[model samples]
Target chain A: MPRLRIQIRDLSKTFREGGREVPAVSRVSLDILDKEFVALVGPSGCGKSTILNMIGGLIAPSAGQMLIDGAPVRDVPRQVGYVFQKDTVFPWRTVTRNIALGLEYRGVTGPEQGRRVGEAIRLAGLAGFEEAFPATLSGGMRQRVALMRTLIVEPEILLMDEPFGALDTHTKLNLHAELLALWEAKHQTVVFVTHDLSEAITLADRIVVLTRRPGRVKMIHEVKLPRPRDVIKLRESDEYAQQYSQIWHVLGEEFAGHAV
Target chain B: MSEKLKINFWRLAILVVGVGAWEWLTGIKAVSKIPGLYFIDPFFISRPSKIVERFFYLNSDEVRLTLWQMLLSTVESTIIGFLVGVSTGFAAGLVLGRNDRLARIFEPYIIAFNSLPRIALVPLVTMIFGFGLLAKVVLAWLIVFFIVFFNTFQGARGVDPDLIHSARFLGATEGQIMRTVIIPSALAWTFASLTPSISFALIGVVIGEFIGGESGGGIGYLIIASLGTLNSADMMVALIVLAITGIVMALGIKQVEMRLLRWRPEYQQR
Candidate 1:
């Protein structure tokens, strides 16, 4: 068995707004093994992002404990990288500069930094647009820049919060293929948060479905899909449909009684 | 004709008609002598031809050097005040913007100072600095500092928190984030304030010179001297020169702004 990379026990977070306590996530416990791709899916306002934020050490949990590699996470871990839902690519910087940001921040310079940035740009399929600004690029291209920026750092744990949630079906499929290819090479532990049930099934080794607001783990289903999967063709398979409906059955229940 | 040429033609036509009407009413004695036309006196509103004649007289070899000297003094003070104000304001904005405690402590004082009509302090500035180039520079600096400071502070404060979070996750220290993320984000707001602040700096320096009167040598001093002698044409000439200077400076700054903000969509369209 793979070693457990992340251990969460009785983790909970409650936010206070307007002098009233607003619970976002209740007591939740789970363990993620090394090299596992775990997807967290739930209805909107279900604290799915809050969980991811806590795991990435972006925000402090109001209660409970989290351990990464047997050590408590008191601050943003050095081995973790995060891709936000919004396009966080700096508009003022070019594609090359944006991808080179992390390396520059770490004081990496000279030919080594150039080689790494060039490789990342090529990997993201952004050749011939190295000097282009973010404002000129399409939404999908900008998101790819954001992804390549995080991926170039080569973090041990990649925390993506609905990274492709904003793209259309065609762009989303293309990104899924690129992401899977990159992951197959690195095999880093990925904790993805999305509301799309089919996306969770396509990418994750395990899918954890959560309840509505003040979210708690409702169900955790292990995906038995084969390796070297084609994101588009795999969706048409019998097992894909079986897993989709089973997770959707649990996920759909949380969406009921809420306005569409 | 193209749209641009058509607009330029209309602009020229309007200027010609306006100046011709002014000259017809005041420059020609016959038109002034007409019934009810005497109210348009050259004494109050100088004729365009007389002002142009005064402009040429000032530009002549005898007085041209003095006129250029005064113009240079005012321009120098305006440029110095702008640079000093922008640099200091940008530094203060970044410092206070990153530190909430510092911002909270200084917020009330900043608002109180900004609320006052800064022009009213021109006389006080003259009294303290003694009606020299120093006083003019100080006045201009005071006017520009607050404009740039407020915009930059708002820009820094309004940076997307997600960007900061992403930077932190990428192993950026606080200093690196400020240098790479906060400064670049605030730059858009800082650049937005530049045109207005530079204009205000010119206004501040002129106001200082106006209060200084004979003690200072600038276009504002020339205007005051013309007013003292009751030479309406000379006053109008100075006013016209000031207007032209302001327009040219604004256009120059706009060009620089476009070049710097080429990354912006608005600039990219052009």
Candidate 2:
């Protein structure tokens, strides 16, 4: 078995708005093994992103402990990377410069920086647009830049919060294919959060379903989909349909009483 | 005709008609004889031709050197004041924007100071700094600082929290985040404030000179001197030069803005 990459023990988060204490995530605990792809799915306002943020060390947990490689996470670990849902690519920086940002911050200069940034540009299929700014690029292209920026740093654990949630179905499928190809080569540990159940089934090794607001683990279903899988073709398979139905049965219950 | 050509034609037409009417009205002796119509007195609102003639006379060799000296003084004070104001305002804005405690402590005082009609302080500033370039510079600085400071402060404060989080995740130190993220984000606002700041700086300097009288040897002083001697034509000539200077300065700033902010969508080349 692969070594455990992340350990979450009774992790919880409560947010304060005005004078009231609103619970976002409650007593959520799960372990992620190295190179495992886990997807957290639930209705909107289910604290899916709050969980990802806590894992990435972007926010302090209100209670409970989160451990990465047996060490408590106090700040963003060097081996961890996070891809936000919003288009966080700096509009001021060009494709090359945006990809080079992390390396530049780490004081990696000279040809080494150029080589890495060039490789990232090629990886993201942003070759001819190397000098192009974010404003000039399409929404899908900009998100690719945002992804490549995080990927270039080569983090061991990649926490993504609905990274492709904003794209259209066509672009979304294309990105899913690209993402799977990249993951197949690197096999990095990934914890993805999404509202789309099909996306969870298509991408994850395991799917963790959570209840509506004040989110808790409702069920955890392991995906037995084989490796080197085709994101588009797999949706047509019976096994994929069965897994989707099973997860949806649990995920649908949470959204039954309200608009999703 | 093209839209731009049509617009320019109308603008020129308006200018001709306006100036032609002004010249005709001032030349009418009967209109001046009527007490109620004396508002357009030739001695006060001088005709366009006399104003143009006075402009040429000021630029003539006999008086050109003095005019040049006065123009240079005003330009120097305006430029110096603008630079000082922008730098100090930008620094203050960044610091206050980044520090909540500092902003909270100083916000009330800043708002109070900004609320005061800055023009009302011109005489007081001139009195303290005396009738010199220093007085004009100080007044210009006072007017420019708040314009730059407020815009920059808003810009710095309005940076997306996601960007800051992304920078931190990428292993950026606080100082690096400030330099790479916060400063660049605030720069758009800072640049937005610059055009107004420069105009206000010139206004402040001229107002300072107005209060300082002829002792402050600048374009403002020349205008005051013309006013004292009742040479309406010379005063109008000085006013035209100032207007031209303001336009030139605004154009220069536009060029710099376009160059610096080419990354912006509006400035991007197709």
The C-alpha TM-scores of every prediction are 0.96, 0.96
The sequence of per-residue lDDT tens digits that candidate 1 reaches over residues A189-254 is 999999999899999999999999899999999999999889999999999999988888878889
Indicate the worst ten consecutive residues by lDDT in candidate 2 chain B: B31-40
B16-103 in candidate 2: lDDT tens per residue?
Answer: 9999999988877665456646436788889999988877777778774477677888889999999999999999999999889999
Can you list the residue pairs that collide in candidate 1? none
Candidate 2, lDDT over the whole model: 0.90
Error of 2 at B148 (Å): 0.7
State which docking tier applies to candidate 2: high
Compose the digit string of candidate 2's lDDT tens values, residues A52-121: 9888888899999899999989878889888999999998889898999999999999999999999888
Error of 2 at A146 (Å): 0.3
Model 1 chain A weakest 10-residue run by lDDT: A251-260
DockQ comparisons of all candidates to the true complex: 0.84, 0.80
> Candidate 2, TM-score vs. the true structure?
0.96
User: Cα deviation of A199 in candidate 1 (Å)?
Assistant: 0.3
